[model samples]
Target: MMRFVFSLMIAVALSPNAAIAQDKPSKAKSWNLTGQVKARFDAKVVDMLCEVSGGAACADKCGGGTQQLGVVRKSDGRLFPVSKNGQPIFSGAMADLLPYCNKDVEVDGLLAGEGDIKIYQVQLIREQGTKKWNKTSGFTKAWRKQFPDAGKKGPWFRNDPRIAKQLAADGWLGLGKEADVAYAKDEVE
Candidate 1:
């Protein structure tokens, strides 16, 4: 009885299920904000992650001119990642704030999940000392025009065409996994 109890305890302690819970990557099925709270404030457009870890210059290096934009609140300097559905509001945020980079923007939207704002609608976007609210659509159009080569290359061009070309030159069709093939021998199709 003593031997069995000790073995059981050891098994329980060593079980993978005994590990403490860890944060999983956000993979929300529904891309919609919950517990929505209406908020309106002015903040400067900044590159979300880089702005926090590195300074403005490091922020600039991300995504060429298309880094995911966030709002750094003027009052508290709290960085709110502008996102909807748990994902960074990629193109839409970029379209709205590309021209307004490092400039103040008046945001009105639903605040949700960690410091993300769900911008279902735009209230206004104005630079300091400017009464005129700039057009949001033109930011995307201008980006395409300016960086014609980099445009339409998907979110930040991490999957740039040049990389594929290089892979093709090396006689790779860009398929298959880097994992051990032997592990899949028992995986019945």
Candidate 2:
């Protein structure tokens, strides 16, 4: 179809090494490096996101800094972010947000008019293993009252499956749920 062919043609034109072509709105997922929007490059709030290869400082940042923020940029392209600042942009921890880099998310960031791109912050949405839910008015009723003030912070703390497993291993009648964790022992010699 003409649409497919046009898309392919735009893609080819957008490559860094590709020659200039007539101006066209870039495909959402693809960028054109020719003109206009390409000119938007080095312009306000828009830029070509590049992958960072490897280096010492880059290692520490992308590896685990785990911080996200909005930054200010200047005419010389110097950024004030605490990391490598004044230079490093789309790469390292920052580039991890690249559409290709993280496929799980739907990118909804922004391109401000001051030669800087703003990201809303990347988040890992999935957590595995058992997760606890609130209990209703059962034996747990009274527990909800003193839970916040308890040194344990809540019945849930003592009721962690890990904690229960350890207690049972130590010969206690370990209860699986928070409410049961407070059971009054009746067996004694």
Candidate 3:
């Protein structure tokens, strides 16, 4: 009986779920400000501004992936602005959706936000008639291609030389060197 009780306590202590529970709370619980919901639907990619203005040639005027892209759901014609992809901070889904401009696609991801300010975070996508799904990792891949010299680890913004140079010139807070010094002095005192 004593041996059985000791083994059970050891098993409980070494359990993966118990270890994870003690390490840290889930970030998803705090970051879910917009009530994110998993969504998988078929939609036609469109330029949000042009679609709103009734421009038939909207996709043609995406300005080389500079313009914002969105999707119009096939079932109800509900428009969803795709603001993010499966990448980390400062990333967008424009590149992932750019290739399928004006074409029908099946998107799987989370729909978040409220009322007129909703956004879609595209996790996976595929052509409407295709069986294979592709992960929405275009932004990070493009960034790696564009900045081959940047380090492989950490967020792209932190490793970007251009951003670092800009931050150095404008201070960490982007309020000029004088302000940064003033703020630091105030905080220290």
- Rank by TM-score (best first): 3, 1, 2
Q: For candidate 3, write residues 90-179 as lDDT tens digits.
A: 789977999888899888776677543556787788897898888888987788888999987888988998998998999988999999
Tens digit of per-residue lDDT, candidate 1, span 51-164:
876774465534555577677767666676764221242445455666677777665544554333233333345676776754334444544565567746565434445655
Instruction: Give the worst 10-residue stretch by lDDT in candidate 1.
Output: 18-27
Q: Model-by-model lDDT, in order?
A: 0.53, 0.28, 0.76
lDDT of 2: 0.28
lDDT of 2 by residue, 1-189 (tens): 999999999998766421221122322222222231221111111122211221222322233223332222222343222111111122222333211222221211112222233222111111113233111112232333435444454455464455556876653544444434455433331
The best-first sequence of candidates by lDDT reads 3, 1, 2
Best by lDDT: 3
Residue pairs clashing, model 3 = none
RMSD to truth, every model? 13.5, 21.1, 13.4
* TM-score of every model versus the real structure: 0.45, 0.18, 0.72
Best by TM-score: 3
Comparison by lDDT, 2 against 3, better one: 3
Give the 10-residue window scoring lowest on summed lDDT in candidate 2.
Answer: 38-47
Per-model tally of clashing residue pairs: 0, 3, 0
